[model samples]
Structures are given as structure tokens and as C-alpha cells.
Target chain A: MNYLHLLDYAGVAVFAATGALAASRLRLDIVGFIFFAAITGVGGGTLRDLLLGKLPVFWIKQPLFIGICVIIAVLVFFTAHLVESRYRLLLWLDAIGMAAYCVMGAMIGLEYGISPYAAIVTGISTATFGGIFRDVISGEKSVLLSDEIYISAALLGATSFVFLFSMGVPQIVAVFVGVLLAFGLRAAALLFGWTTPRYKPRQGRKIK
Target chain B: MNYLHLLDYAGVAVFAATGALAASRLRLDIVGFIFFAAITGVGGGTLRDLLLGKLPVFWIKQPLFIGICVIIAVLVFFTAHLVESRYRLLLWLDAIGMAAYCVMGAMIGLEYGISPYAAIVTGISTATFGGIFRDVISGEKSVLLSDEIYISAALLGATSFVFLFSMGVPQIVAVFVGVLLAFGLRAAALLFGWTTPRYKPRQGRKIK
Candidate 1:
């Protein structure tokens, strides 16, 4: 439990940093950086809790989480120019955060007695929805719309956790495996420039 | 209660049509049209429900609501070419949908014993968030970023409803007034090209 809590906090800080980096890229003000950071830090968990009918929301219940995000945002705001290749940094940090979040989300779903299929979906959503929200708000194309294997990696991770759990694997072991799978896939995709195929329209077929 | 239900259904249909119109403008396929319509129709209410910790979201429970949205999307898909000035039609329909949704969201918030201030925020969010989601997904800039009075109108309408409710006004009458205020404000804005002032940075002022 303690380890999970640490992972959760670390995931949030990393996500917040990614959002702050995005805000810096757009040259937004400090307020914009904080707002984006806070949203990206908790957006996925908030959505998962909402879908699960959890009350008060996690961040609302624990102001410490938001405080952490704000602090990270402020730090990123002041130090953005000190970093080179901000985009690469954002991608790696986001990948690690998504990996941790996917496991946490899947566990929460199972704890709530949601069906396994639904739980996997919840996990994937938790891992990816925050980035989607951030991208949309910042006028960047959503990860979902890209050919990158981001969501697929989350889905694979989530499914592995659920499958391993159902097969009598220890909860911690299952989570470890899931996180490794997600992080490994994402890292490989980033390093190797792997991508999913884009949908191509058929010739002479009117889309409308 | 029945009247409220009717208004909800009508609002969903109207919102769905607007989404379908957006898809048509983007030259998306049938699946895209349906996807956009469904999201726009239920996005605001779903967010409200999730935030309020309401289970089994409205559309999931009813299914009829989603069915109606799908039907509307199909209709818009087929009839898009027959309509002149689809953009104008979409704007008008979206305004009407926002008005109805604002009142419905306020009523739901009051039923849940939320504070009046929060309830008003809920109303405005419920009226406008769907459009924001739609715009984001369609790769269009959200109306919130525009100098338009859209969100302000929702805020005004929601505040009116909550205030009137607190003053012991009848629910139906308060709702009527709220909807009228929102609709009228939006209509006037559309007609007269009313706009709020945009924020301009001072010369030589660093944003950081």
C-alpha cells in the first residue's frame, strides 16, 4: 500500500511536469502552466472516479495532491529554459506516468467489482484520457488521433494486470508486470519510432 | 417531471444534430458522425453526473437517449447537402440545446443538495462542456477561446435559475425563465455579433 501511494504521487508529479512543459512550449503565463499541470495531473483519475461513481474526487479529498502539482508546475515554469529537448522529456515522463496510472486504475476498478472488460477499459481510459484532455485544451492533436501506439500499450498493460490477477498472481506482482509491459512498449515505440497503421480511405468512396 | 424529461430529450437531439453538422463539415464518415453526435449529446450531462457521483450515467441507463442521438446523426448525415448554411443552422440548434441543458443541470444539482454556487457552475458546465468536447475532438478551437458570449450566457442563465430557486420560485417557472434568458442572450449574440473583449498583452511585457 505504501509503495502504491508513492507510485501514485510520483505519477502525478511526472504528469504535471509534462503538462507544464506543454504550457511552456505554448509560451503561456504561469497561471496557464499551473492550470494545465493540475488538469493533466488529475484529469485521468478524476474521470475514472467519476465513471465509477466515486464521490468527492481524489484531489478534492486530498489537497496535498493538488499542492504537489502546483509546486511542480511552478518549478517547471521557472526552469523551462534550462532544459533542452523538452518534447522528448515530456514524452518519457508521460509514458512512465501512464504506466503507473494504468495499474492503479485497473486495481481500483477491480476493487469496485466492475466487470473485467469494463475494468480494462477503465484502466486504459485512466492512462490516456488526461493527455487527451490536455492536448485538446492546448490545441494539439490528441494522442488517440495519432498513429503512435500509446493507447494500445495502455490497453495491453491493463489487460495483463487483469489477466494475471484472475490467474492467482500476487497483486503486487501483477501490477509490476503490467507497469513494465506498458512502460516497455511505450519506450520502445518512442526509441524505435514505431507506429500503428493509419486508416486510409478507399478510392472513389465518398466519406460523407 | 415529464416536461423536464421532454426538454432533456429535445436538447439531446438538438446537440446531436450540431455534432453531426460538425462531422459533415469535416467530411467524416458515418461512424464519425455517430461518434461525434453521441459525444456531444451526452458529454455535458455525463460530466455532470460523474462529478456528482451519480452512477449508471443517464445515457447508459436510458439507452433511448443514445438511440435518439444516433438517429439524429443519421438524419443529419443524409440531409446535410439539402440544407443551406449548415453552420448557421448548427449554431441556432446548439443555442437551443444549451438553454435546455443548463436548466436541466441546475435542477439535477439542486436535487443532489449541492450548494447554489456549485449548482450554477454545474449548470454552466453542463450547457457548455459538450460543445467544448465536440470542438476539441473536431480539431476546431473551442468557443470558450473565442470572444463569444456563449459561456457567459450559460452562466447568466444558471445563476438566474439558482437564485430564483432559492427565492422559492416554482421549479417550472424558474426553469422557463432560465432557459429564456440563456436562449435570448445567445440569440442576440448571434444576431448582433456581440463579443467580449480579448485580452491583449502589453508591448515588451514578458509573459513569464
Candidate 2:
């Protein structure tokens, strides 16, 4: 298999692990883990395809994508407790998945003739929306709701790809540049607790 | 507009109102309120159409469907507190929207040549998934997670339509039968606290 295909599958596996880990924390049933894993792994791309009018979505024809998620989820369900620091694992794994997905999503958008700006937006949605759906559906505070650098990292990656490609960079080079930059920023955020600057608070604002 | 069109619009408006009300409870910003409204209004049909491979989705082509949701959400943002019993209003409005969406989803599914059983599944997904996403994203317990009769109501409506249509009932008559039964059941559940039967206690089960 090509490197891109390998990256794609690895991304799916890592994200699925995160999802299954979340399900384990919630003490959900096996079915819940698989459901969460499947959605988290595929949700972002599904949204991208649907919005872009790509018929049948990416996973419908080759359900091996979904099968990978299901298997990972089941594995995590059984072995999650063995992980020393699930939260840290979740962050590191999510960083890997997010970068790969961001580039992949942008690639698809560009292929579909979407404009650069909208393609970046598509990339961001692809990388982050799945985790948002996963956390939200699980009654966890959504990642987007946090005043963190997570989504900003995705934005950076997508923008970098668009800019590089527009500047005549080879598609492969642009993709790697984007993915590495995004993953690096996210990793830094996790390691150093970097966060977005919060808005100056107005009095009487009840931030729930 | 035809009767079906009226139902469709009204259903969207009501669902949007529910979404806005949920956002109000969460004290979300106006943008958040409107975003919630649009998703809650169109989320189900979006899922249905995407799965059925109906390209561009129902809203991408019309745009008016999204416009209606935005208008309702904004109106509700300023007026939600005026309602004395927002929860009661939410339940009633949800009942109306759910019934209409269920029938509409089924109609589209059957039109696409999906089997009746899968069509019913489609209807349930279309009617309930939007609300599921709304509540989950808003950090509220999802309706589907509750041991309630909500999905059952949608199931009944879709099934009734499929049965009536297959039995040579007029299409319009079948539609009405489905919508009415769904609404009736949901309304009854709200009024009477009619819940799904729970399994007999397996003690020490942490059904969180």
C-alpha cells in the first residue's frame, strides 16, 4: 500500500482507540464502544463528503474502514485499563489522526474544485468534527468548547497546504508540510499546555 | 403550498424552536443558538439524504429550509423566556416535528426503493438524529439515551405508513396515518409519562 493509504489507516486506528477509550471511561457496553469508535473514525470524512455532494461517502463501498474502527474499539474496550494515562494517550493519538485527516480532507476538497478558503474550512471540519461529535454525544465537554489550541492547529495545517499548493509546491510535499506542522503544533500544545488567548471578560458574563 | 409542504415547513420551524430553547437553557451566544437551530431542524433529513445518496442534500439546493430554521432560532433566542413552561412547549413542539419528519423520511426512503424495514430505520434516524446531535452537543443527555418511548413513536409512524402504502392505501392517506399515529403516541407519552418497559433488575448493574 502507498504511504498515504498507510497514514489514512493509522489515523483511523488511533482515532478509534481514542473513541473506545472514551466509551470505556463512561462504562458503556461493548456496542457503545463500537458505535462511538465507528462514528469518531468516520464522522469527519462523512460530513466532508456529504457537504461536497460526494455520493455514498468514503466508507460505504469499502467498509473495511469501518471494520478497522470496530476492531480497534473492541480491542480498546478490553485493554483500556492497561493504559497508564489514557488522557495523554488520547491527546497524542488524536494529534496524529487530526493532522492526517486535515490533509486528507483538504486533498478531497481540492480534488472537488472547492476554493482554497473553503477547502481549508473543509479540512478543519474533517479533523475536528468527529471528536466534537464523539465527546458531545458521550456527554463529555466538547473539544470545540474548550479555549484551547486544538482547532487552531488544524486551521494552520489546512491553510499551510492550501498556500503551499497554490505556490506551486508538489501536492505530496504540501501535504506532508501541512500534516507535520499541524501535528507539531498540537503536540506542543499537549506538552506545554498551550491555549488560545481568551477574550477579555465583560462583567456579568456567565460563562457556563 | 401543498399540505405536505406546509407540514415540512412547520416541522422545521418547530424543531428549530426546540433547538433554540435548548441553547437558551445553556446560555449560548446568538451564533451558537442559530447554529443549534439549523442543525436540529435539518440534521435528520441530512442524514437520510446522505445515506440515500441524494446529492447536495435537501437544504443545499433549497437554502430556504436553512433560512426558516435561522429565523425561528433567532426569534426564540429573544422570546424563549417569555414562555412560562418552556419544557412543556418543547415536548409538544418536538412531538409535532418528530411526527412530520418521521413520515417525510419514510416517504423519501420508499421513493428511493429501500426496503420497508430499512425505510423505517431511515425514518427514525431522520426524525431523531438531529435532536440527538443537538442535545449531545449542548452537553445535555441525549433523548435516545433515555429509556423513553420517543424512538418507538417514530418507529410506529414509519411502520404504519409502510404497511398502509403496501396494503394499497392511497399514498396521502398512508402519510396521514403515519404522521397522526406518531404524533399521538409522542403526545400521549408526554402527558402520561408512558415509558418503555425496563428490564427486571439485575442488581449491581450500574446503568449509568
Candidate 3:
């Protein structure tokens, strides 16, 4: 299989697993678990296709994606009790999925002749929108808006990939650099508890 | 004001009110209530615009939509007890909003020169997606899936409006017809307690 296809499968699997894990946390039924996984696994790509005016959508034409998601969801559902420390597993898997999606989205945008700036944004969006969607459906606030290196790391990775590709770097090399940048940044943030600064409003005072 | 603009305003108000009611049912905070209302009021249009590659999104460009939604949300939050028995009020409002979105979406789709079938589908999508989104976020099975007459009514209304416009009907007449169609269908369903057939799994009893 081509590198892109490999990355796509890996990304979809990781995303589906993470999504199922989240749904399991909610103690939802099997169908609900599969629904969450399927939505998260394909949501970003579906949105990208719709935006690009691609017809029929990606997952619709390829039933394999749905099948994979359902399989992962079912496996997770039955084995959830054996999985110790679900939070840690979900975090690491999500980070890996994030990197994969960012790189793939940037590659697709470039293939479609989108501007570099827009391509980078789309890449970051692809990496984060699925998690945001999962959170929203589960009635939780989106982690993307919180103090994290998530979107910023994806942005950096996408920029690096796009830049290297534009400079005639080999596709595999560009993807490696992008994924490493994202993974390293995310790991640093998690290990060090890096946070965005919060602004505090003055007590009993209005600041315009 | 142009008839189209007036209908759009009415639609926004109706959807915003329904969102507010749903938020109230969940006893969300003021911020949460307005957030839900704003999203439910404009989510469909935002999705449609994003799919059409419209920049900045619809509600982002027109902050008035958000402003109106917030006001309605605040009103609902403060007056929840009074409207608790006014569930029909919410339904009628939602119908109006769906109708307005259908017409506006159809108009934009036609302007963009999309195929007639796609335009009509887009219109229906633009009308119903907000409600689907609201239900998903609120952690309820979407009414769209179980409510038979709902989305279909919106589709019929939009198609009829487009057909009338193509036949040189006046814009005001088209709007009236669309709104009536959607509202009339919904009211009929409500009065008759109509619903889609529930999906049933095979019990698989061994034949003796």
C-alpha cells in the first residue's frame, strides 16, 4: 500500500479506538459506542470532502472505513474492563491520530491546489474537529479550546509538511518530519503540563 | 424590509426559542443556554455555508443572529416556569425557522447554479441539520430520525418553493407557501401523534 493509504488506515483505527474509549466512559450501549467511533473516525474527512464539493462523501463510497470503525468499537466494548487506565490510553492514541490526520489533511489540501495557509488550517481542523465533536456529543466542553498544545502542534506540523513539500522534499521525509514535530510537541505539553495563560478579570471593576 | 430578510429574522427567533426551551429542560446555566440556542439557530446555515466554501461562516459574519439567539435564550431562562406547558409554542416556532431556512438555502443553492436535485437536498439539509446538531449535543436521539414528517416536510416545502420560483411565482407567495407547508405538516403530525416506524431486531426464536 502507498504511504498515504497506510497513514489513512492507521489514523482511522486510532481515531476509532479513542472514540470508542470515550463512549465507553459514558457507559453507553454498543450501538452508541459504534456511533461515536464512526462519527469521530470519519467526521473530519467528511467535512473536508463537503467543503471541497466532493460528492457522495469519502466514507459513503468506502464501506471499509465504517466496517473498521465498527470492528474497533466492538472490540473495545467487550474488552473495556480489561483495559486499565483508559484515560492514558485514550490520550496517547488521540495524539497519534492527531498527527496522522494533520499530515494527511495537509497532503490532500496541497493535492487540491489549496493555498498553503488554508492548507495548514485545514490540517489542524482535521486533527481537532473530531475530538471537539466527540466532546460535544458527550456533553463535555471541547479540550481544543483548553490550554493544550493540540491544535498549535497540529498547525506547526502542517506548516512544516507543506513547506517541505513545496521545497521538493520527498513525501515520506516530509510526513516523518511533520508527524515527529506534532508528537514531540504534544508529548512535551503532557509531560510538562504546559498551559496557556489565563486572563483574570479585576474584582468588582469593569475593564473596557 | 425585504420579505426574505423578514422571514430569516422570524426563522432565527423561532429556532432560538426552541433551543432555549431545550436548554431549559436540561437546566443549563445562562451561558450554556445562549450557546445552545445560538448554535441551534444558526448551525444549519453555518454547515451549508461551510460546504459551499463560503468564508467566515454565516453567523460569524452576521453577529445579529447570535445577538438574537442570546436574547431569546435569556428570556427563556428567566421564564422557564411560564413556558413549561407551552411545548406547542416551541414546535410552531421550530417549524417557522425550518421553513425560512429551507427557502433561504434553496435560493442560495440556485444562485450557485447547483443541480436542482442537489439544491433541494441542500435546502432540506440546511433546515434540519441544526435540530439534529442540537439533539446530538444535548445527548438525545435526534428527533429527525424518529420524527417521520419533520425533515420530509422541510424537503417538500423547499422543493415546492423552488418549483414556484422557477415558475415565476412571486417571492412573497413562495415564502408563504413554504412556511405553511412546513408548519401545516408538523402541526398535523403533532395532533395525530405520527412517528416513524421503530427499527426492530429479529428475536430469532428457534422454530419448534
Give the TM-score of each candidate.
0.61, 0.63, 0.58
Evaluation by lDDT, superior candidate among 1 and 3: 1
Supply fnat for every model shown: 0.14, 0.20, 0.04
Against the native chain B, each candidate's TM-score is: 0.94, 0.94, 0.89
What is each predicted model's overall lDDT from 0 to 1? 0.83, 0.82, 0.76
Tens-place lDDT digits, model 1, residues A153-207: 8877998999999899999899999999999998888889776542233322233
Residue A177 error for model 2, in Å? 18
The segments of candidate 3 whose C-alpha lies over 4 angstroms from its true place after superposition are A196-208, B1-132, B135-208
Stronger candidate by DockQ (1 vs 2)? 2
Runs with alpha carbons beyond 4 Å of true place in candidate 1: A29-31, A202-208, B1-45, B51-53, B56-132, B141-208
Q: Candidate 2, after superposition: displacement of residue A49 in Å? A: 1.7
Error of 2 at B109 (Å): 0.7
In candidate 2 chain A, what residue range of length 10 has the lowest lDDT sum?
A: A199-208
DockQ score of candidate 3?
Answer: 0.06
Model 2 bad stretches (over 4 Å): A1-43, A51-128, A134-139, A146-208, B145-148, B202-208
What digit string (tens of lDDT, one per residue) describes model 3 on residues B95-124?
778878887887777776665555665677
lDDT for A44 in candidate 3 is 76
TM-score comparison, 2 vs 3, better candidate: 2
